[model samples]
Target: MSKKPIKRLAFENLTIEFGDKKIVDNCSFEFPLNRKIRMLFNNDVNKYAVLHAFTQVEGITQGKYFFNEDDVTQFSFEEFMSYRLNMGIGFSTRGLLHNRSLQENLLLPLMYHKMMSMDEALEHLKKFYEYFDISSVKDRRPAEVGPNMQKATLLIRAFIHEPEIVFLDNPEMLLSKGLYANLLQLIDDQVEKGNLKHLFFSTEDEDLSDCIADGFIIVKKNKFEFVENKKQMRLAV
Candidate 1:
């Protein structure tokens, strides 16, 4: 078989601070794109901060962020917007548009970035609607849905565009253990197809990391580091 391409997304001595409070200290690490990696966070605050960093919504105080060896430490809003099409980001249901139905929200990315017609977008959604369980409730607005359906909507929004890389920010935060397990299996199945790369950030324990993650990232004491031994991750805390 031909060798798979090697892709790198890294943070070089990156520092993220608010005023004098350092959220994530000077840290550097690369996410291996050959496998799905789980970034473990002890608290909710740091987890989302890292997601914002990936999306360039929050700027770092020092150091550089790189994608494919290109410096992207200080991307402008417009630049980042254009860049995010190849990147998918998942947020809490709170991030979903309250006034729009799930179908409309899912169609936005395909319409905006891919320039697909409304009918075409809906047709495309048919491909993965069952995977996310959003087809039945796709017409419901945020207020009309429960947390499970809302979370499904968020997943649809993030993945509808079929971006090369996906950043899932606590995708299972609102899910039950069983449902979350199913989600993990689904993620592994998708990764096995070698079409998408995933970086999952969650406050859950290391047990979840062992499920399908090929590597582990630990964010502790205001710094980020990779855990060499995936087995020691649970005790690393």
Candidate 2:
């Protein structure tokens, strides 16, 4: 007998609100497994709030986030930490540790989780440095590097741990054209190797979305709606 495939991440009767304002109002959506999704929002605040909620950086006022049939919103602290380790997040403005050097910031998650020893972690990251071509700024702190290098480092950090799902908020904001192309290629390679199962990104760049998104999650009329990519649908047909 063959084993059944696991279900993907899902939001059930989800509601996120601030004091008096609701960002996600009783929305329910199940994300497709191993697919790249673009999050489309008419409001920037709604975009940031929704992404933060998905990442568990912000609390949901109501509803449950189910990952692989488990309710993550109810997870214990340690359990949540473990859950987060499986996710890689690239923030639009901030995520890097200001006090740590670029290389150290990249190594922190692996070492802190005891995923690997210092030597092993360094060895693992070597390919990323070469691929992103940011080795020169490795020893510098986040503040010390220019915006392009900082963004490159952020991208590198996101993929270094080989997380199952990567959530990127405005991934193309400060990256140069060359770096952006490299980022896309890196995502493709990881997906092909089965290291990355899902990718969700919020971007204003339509060209970027068209290039990669297999589906879309759109915020419409205060509710979250899933839209299958027409391009993918055509390809499948």
- Candidate 1 ranges beyond 4 A from true positions: 1-6, 42-45, 176-178, 203-208
Candidate 2, residue 144: lDDT: 93
Q: What CA RMSD would you report for each candidate?
A: 4.1, 4.4
Maximum-TM-score candidate: 2
Clashing pairs in 2: none
Evaluate model 2: give its lDDT.
Answer: 0.80
Worst 10 residues of 1 by lDDT: 1-10
Candidate 1 backbone overlaps, count: 0
C-alpha displacement of 62 in model 1, angstroms?
1.4
Q: What are the lDDT figures for the candidates, one per model?
A: 0.68, 0.80
Question: Over the stretch 1-237, how does candidate 2's per-residue lDDT look in tens digits?
Answer: 111233568888888875567877887877877789887776534677777888873668788898777787888767677567778899887888999999999999888778889999999988899877888889999999988888888888888888888999888989887777888889998988888888988887888888989898776535666779856433432
Residue 89, model 2: lDDT of 91
